[model samples]
Target: MQTTLMIYDGTAPADSGVPRTGGVPLAPAGFTWPICGSSCGGPLQFFAHLPVEDGVLSVFVCQNDPGACESWDATSGANRVYLFPREELQPVEAPATGVTLLPATSAIRTHVVTLDPAEDDDHDELAPDAYDLARSGWKREPEERFGKQREVLGSLGGSPSYLEDDRLPACPACTDTMEFAAHLEEGISAQSAMNLGGRLGYVFVCRACREGAFLTD
Candidate 1:
């Protein structure tokens, strides 16, 4: 059975240039994703994703003042979108409805497209299985849903890479959100039992506000 997933796309504030979206709460973390690093600019919000074409890239905007780094224009160059193979996507079980994220195989071919401003987002005609795959990559599937604690902890070796859906940090100075700066392939872990899967994401602070961002992979 295929399940569906919900993903968000939004821009970071001018001070912090971290792009972000909403996700199911993960206990202590509350409403947040990975912060890239310090020296990020402003706060970022989740807007929407590009269409299935051209790799299904997600889009984020910079709501900072024009006087700031003008991240809105700078962010145009970022590879914010991603496309995943059908096998890599996962079906999340909704506790309330008991319905999975992807209800059918059609979800594997799904992609998202977000319009601007976000104030008027309406999926009136969208099917129930849209946004089935939240993360890409072969390893992301089991790790995200069923990977053991040790798997996530011990796997944090080698290079580091940022996940397309990570919640980057916002700027502290001007409060603009930061953008996806770069990905890290390798990373180290604190303990063997602390595996969130070997893969990890790194977000950077916005260049304009110098705030911190988060990373994911």
Candidate 2:
């Protein structure tokens, strides 16, 4: 797991002034800014710093994995970067003026893999944000479906990992608790090693009542 910081200038907004042609003023060394996700070969570079509504300028790290370690350093990082003028960053539709552009919604897609015990403790903390993004999708730039990570679930017969969408037996409609769905005789993904954390079992809502929780092996 890698961490990136979002730095926005607190100063006031102004018209397109002189282009600040240089690297960002600050960021952690070796942080990889994401232009897109690993699956899409993203976590791309920032063309340049962007100015926001209140004359605020902002910078952020790319969360994509393939471009994880890439940076804007003169020596180590790539030279070509992306920069969007304030006017260009404005809203396409009316009543939504003065909003900064983010990575395209499609570009923000990620797989927030939940972990079971003895897998990777370091990743558990990172699960929520990643999972939220994977399930609901992003709201900012490049409008598109963030989409579900249903593809990540795969099948239970071969792999040992389980996806929250598949394991958390909730009523698809109201999300009420469901009954026990089933336990796989074999592993699902690498994460099926533990019975806790919604792995090892399948839960479902009452066909009528529709309420459920996970039952692990």
User: Which parts of model 1 are misplaced by more than 4 Å?
Assistant: 1-166, 187-197
For residue 29, model 1's alpha carbon misses the true position, in angstroms, by 34
- Tens digits of per-residue lDDT for model 2, 33-147: 4333223343333222322222323222232332333321211232222223234343121112211222211001122233233343334665443322322331223454343
Model 1 lDDT on a 0 to 1 scale: 0.26
Each candidate's lDDT (Cα)? 0.26, 0.27
Give the candidate number with the greatest lDDT. Answer: 2
TM-score on alpha carbons, each prediction? 0.22, 0.18
N/CA/C clash count, model 1: 86
